[model samples]
Target: MLSTSMTSAVIPIRTVYGEASTGTSSQPMNGTVVHEQQVRTARSYQAALSDWKRWAADHAYALHTIQPEAWSSNGGSIAHDKFSDLDMLIPLLADKRIVYLGENSHGVAEFNLVKTRLIQYMHQTLGFNIVAFESGLGDAALAQGQIKMTATQETMMRSIFGVWWTKETKPLFEYMKETHKSESPLRLTGFDIQVQSPLFQNANWIPSNGLKDRALQAEQEVHKWRMSKDLSGFRKAKRELIKVYEELLQVVTKNENALKMDYPDEPHIVKLMKRALEDRIRVIQEFNELCIQSNILTEQEDYSASQSMMEWRDRAMASNLAWLATEIYPEENIIVWGHNGHISKAQSLISTMPKSMGELMSKELQQESYVMGLFMGEGQAAENTREPVQLDPIIPGSMEDILSAAGQPYTFMDLRYRENERGNSWIFERMIASYQVMMPMSLELRRHFDGVLLIKQVKMPTYLPHKVTKQIG
Candidate 1:
């Protein structure tokens, strides 16, 4: 990270289909020029895509050899050196403090493999040791606290969503185990506020139950609001929760040493105590946003996963990420794993929805953070344990089509730009970049992500077998 550039060990024999390394723009990409870019995106689409193949041939980073590792019999890596194709991105992302590696969904097989490779690169080369996942913050923290350094599969699965425990990601788990024995260690944590169970309310962590009693009553009130939207009751509960939380935070800040005596055997006792408190606060903050959402959508008969609900969740996530970056690991660099929708600076096509987490972080962290969105041309898509669906061919002029035309199985492009010069319309034009619903984000394509990594074709993730999951849990 100290330097922006690193030469790839194996460069392509010839630059085929935009396989050459090229910089798109010198000016920094930010919100200041979003309105201007949106106007530029209105340029003739046909003109932009006519030379798509030429642009792709000249700009795409062709990558077909970057595959997942092959494991040996004794938990050793039989896999060779890899991801040289990614060296081109070193300069674009090296200076970033927090890099969000995001997926269109939780289901792509190849996405996991490539992400693991990226994680390794970040850890070994860029000095990023912490990875904050979109999982339960308290659950992951408490699970990791029990381990000395390396974590077991079950412990990890228990903490995060099932999307991460796939066969493709098993190597990452093993890598964590291996690195723990060395001078460099890749530590895993979660930034999400939601937890499987209520945290820090038991007698083990808190000597007195005054805070716990107040928290339980607040929880009950929340449940009541869920069953029946009693806004007044919920308001009372939220106020009480905030009051009690402030008191607990004050005590922890004032007397962390005195509290540590209660957890004599715990290794990360201090972090555990503070993280548990943070978890509760996140839940409260989430509910606080939800209150706004409830005002908007609760009156409707069918309020199932409304856009407003998603907006509130994104707001909560942004808040948690800010806490993680500024408070939890101020000096250490971190990588974030989550969905493309959460990490993109692009606004939702529906103007009414709240701003996304990526947009918020873009404003908060500015150039210090980088977001890269993953997409594919043709592929099988699935959620965890669900049947895979064959993806329709790429839309004629979509970003995927242009990239796949590079004739390579994988390609990458940085969307940052100087000005909307002609022939690069595809980069600036209002086009769908993903295979899913292709909801228009109103902004120019370049604003959606700092850069994009393309997979020509992909298969659905190989979900971990039930027995494997059971054992891990």
Candidate 2:
């Protein structure tokens, strides 16, 4: 018989959430500090089920995935097939106003498996709707707006189109187009940029009209920078050049009045001007340093750099949020797919504003709809071989290690490393390069959503030792 003390031993449910604050009690792992919300005791996995049920009911959402924290090489036997992917969450999410799909980490094949499954669910089960990516922001803007692409924007779009239309990303668009035509007619949005040739060509030449000679001279200074025989260095030069041109153009573009400008503003304007000038000088000095980081840049002088991509990401997020504010319906089901970084709470666009244009429009249009983020698991064993963690702090051992330590029984899965040179080459080095692109999208999830469901997995090896530590004196 179990003793009363043994039965009553408390197991604290420790939760680390993004919203927790730092510099306070019970600091959250993600830099936020939060007090322990509650304490509970459970005798078995079955008892813990009640806690999850209660959590789901209170939050109006269901989280379906085995926690890595639950896996212990010493604690018990773990099975390879123990975890559930998005397919398990689909039915639960059927009634949701919005479903956020965050990809697994870079170089993790399991994420692609999850993504494929989600796409299938969206097609066969959910039907068509808007499909957002971590990439494709510029093209999305062009598709939505009636205004002709500015020379700069057009170049940016073409560059992006060239990069993403390749083998790796082509299927995502094909899937979107096919599904859109059949079901809901999807819209595309992204927060990525193209950083290569043809698109970055000197297409935006200032007209040699009398007042713009300085602009032409600046462009020439940037062009001569190409002789360094390094594409990455030249990209820095181009970004600097573009910044200078934009500042110079701003002066010519906007007519100023003295009254609206504070006399103190003159000093501010001077500072701004000096900053722009100095930026170009800094770019020249840092050109050599930039070249060393160029392995990610294409061998061909064809691709663009992260600066333009980051700029485009901001514009895309702004535009998409604006569109959502108007067109999205309250209580209607919506699903958004993007990279892990883009949907995180800290940098996401949605979290930054309480009432975005999309939120306002959503309120006026949809009623009381909600948004949420799906934080995908990355850098864990089940995700990426390129990056791996030996232990989980909360659990204190590997999936195998924990089971061994605890003298528990478990099964393990066979995880194989598969690499597609054509398919995955660009994902880390080039694709999803800008953290700015990922941040805002994730923020919106944390801010606008009623609750979040994080998706992660653990891959257990097939072999395990019968004993972890033999106490041989």
Question: Which candidate number has the best lDDT?
Answer: 1
Output the worst ten-in-a-row residue range by lDDT, candidate 2. Answer: 464-473
Q: What is the overall TM-score of model 2 with all chains considered together?
A: 0.37
Candidate 2: clashing residue pairs, number: 49
lDDT of each: 0.63, 0.34
Question: Per-residue lDDT for 232 in model 1?
Answer: 59
Candidate 1 minimal-lDDT segment of 10 residues? 1-10
What tens-digit string does per-residue lDDT give for candidate 1 at 1-473? 10112112111121113223444454545744322221122323344465765777677786656455444434323333454666776888788898988887677888888888778767766788888888767656655554343356765665577766788877776776556556656667776654443445343455457776765565444434444455556565676676776677776767666655543323445765576676566656565446444655656745543566666667767877787678777888989888887787865643455567788764658578888888876768675544686776665656776787777887877777335544455676555455232332333567778778888788888787543221000
Off by over 4 Å in 1: 1-48, 69-81, 149-151, 197-272, 275-282, 285-308, 348-350, 362-364, 384-387, 417-419, 435-443, 465-473
The local distance difference test score of model 1 is 0.63
C-alpha RMSD values across all candidates: 11.9, 20.0
